[model samples]
Target: MEEYAREPCPWRIVDDCGGAFTMGAIGGGVFQSVKGFRNAPVVSLKDSLLGFRHRLKGSANAVRLRAPQIGGSFAVWGGLFSTIDCGLVRIRGKEDPWNSITSGAMTGAVLAARSGPLAMVGSAMMGGILLALIEGFGILLTRYTTALEPRLALATYSSPDPLAPGHLQVHAR
Candidate 1:
């Protein structure tokens, strides 16, 4: 029997953290830039050019200062979540969305524990729900694609020319 190659836990955690950090950094940069531009003061028409320059500068500064903070937060959250997920998989001896949802909830609760009991509960619920929705969507997408695959293959092999006589043209709506 050929054994399936799998990434070790440490490397998987590292990969998850690095990817999450990069995603967070880029997303934070764009969000902060837009927010800064929107909050920038609009001066009189006479100084519109100055206003524009101010907005540009403000946006750049926001990106420079806030992006790293947001990125670090995301990295921490991701690392903790991934670690929990790996641990759950090891304990349960299986892999599934339950692990992700549980991990997300635990990570959120852990991160928010310093805030208060209410905050921890709220964060845990929010995290679990969010992960559940994401996993549900993924499952739906996979099922839809799998269901379509045979039909798509049939369509492709049925006829070379759509306009030919007796050609069954499949229209996907």
Candidate 2:
């Protein structure tokens, strides 16, 4: 009960999303105002402020239009990645570049299909190659770090003694 009482409100995270609206307003307002002044160097401060207001309105509308695309992409990407990754690991007992690239391309194609049929193929190619490269980078990073400092390896990072409380233990070697 004490822990629950001390915990922060769950709505706090949702409230943070609202802050993006204000940030977008300010960003759009300032950007358009600056551009307007640049194009017409002799514009008055009042005119610039009015331009800012109009830009702010447009920016709010743009956000509304883009919300669906953004949300859809988030859902599709996460769902595809998790599903494909798990499937590959289950079958092969480990993930590899081939599986990563194939899964990435499939998901990318679906994502790009929203734009057009042609875009789907292109996006798949790009996504597959990019995912493979990313995986390669991860492998290299782990190997490099493990060689330079063995203690920083993945196995070393695991908690060695979960049964004991109040202290975290890791193997020395």
Candidate 3:
């Protein structure tokens, strides 16, 4: 909805998918270890990824099925957060750091809705604060620039045409 054009290159999608997978694996490992899962940590992660549908390979075959769900949750979170950010920006007159925090918190609350009221509130607060800090830093670094001289908005060029019929020539600026 933003009027400003997005970059033609789409590294954001790559970042989201790759980052989600990494986080999923880490989350799976930590949770499995903490909960005392019997399978090898790697198996536990793989089993979760498999959704416990097909036969489990290695120690993870019997690992509790939650990996796939968690990964999907992350993917959803990334997508929903992006949508919310765009929506908020479009609804508002302009983009600001506030929108970043607002969208982040809203996304977090929705993701944690199933956990409980407390979780929703906690997640929302954390998400909002985290985004505020990160976005604020980014705004400072990119939006405000120190310059040696003001950038040229317009330049005038007036010169004789290289190819001309006669002494009478075209001039442009």
lDDT for each residue of candidate 2 in 49-86, tens digit (9 for 90 to 100): 87766665555555555554445445456556556655
- Per-residue error for 114 in candidate 3, Å, reads 1.5
Which ten-residue region of model 3 has the weakest summed lDDT?
Answer: 148-157
Candidate 3 global TM-score? 0.49
lDDT tens digits, residue span 1-173, model 1: 23335577788789888888998999999999999888877765688889899899889989999999999989999899999999998999988889999999999999999999999999999999999999899889878988888778655335778688767756554
- Provide the RMSD of all predictions against the true structure, rounded to 1 decimal: 3.9, 12.3, 12.4
Ranking the candidates on TM-score from highest down gives: 1, 2, 3
lDDT tens string, model 3, 1-173? Answer: 22445532245445665677668756865565445434433434546666442223322432245555666667777767767777786789676778779988998898899999999999999999999999888767665553411443223334466354453433333
Runs in model 2 deviating more than 4 A are 1-46, 109-121, 150-173
- Shift in Å, residue 25, candidate 1: 1.0
Sliding window of 10 residues with minimal summed lDDT for model 1: 1-10
lDDT of 1 at 140: 95
Candidate 2 global Cα RMSD: 12.3
Residue pairs of candidate 2 with colliding backbone atoms: none
Cα deviation at 17, candidate 3, in Å, is: 6.8
TM-score of candidate 2 against the unseen true structure: 0.50
- In terms of lDDT, the poorest run of 10 residues in model 2 is 1-10
Q: TM-score for all predictions?
A: 0.85, 0.50, 0.49
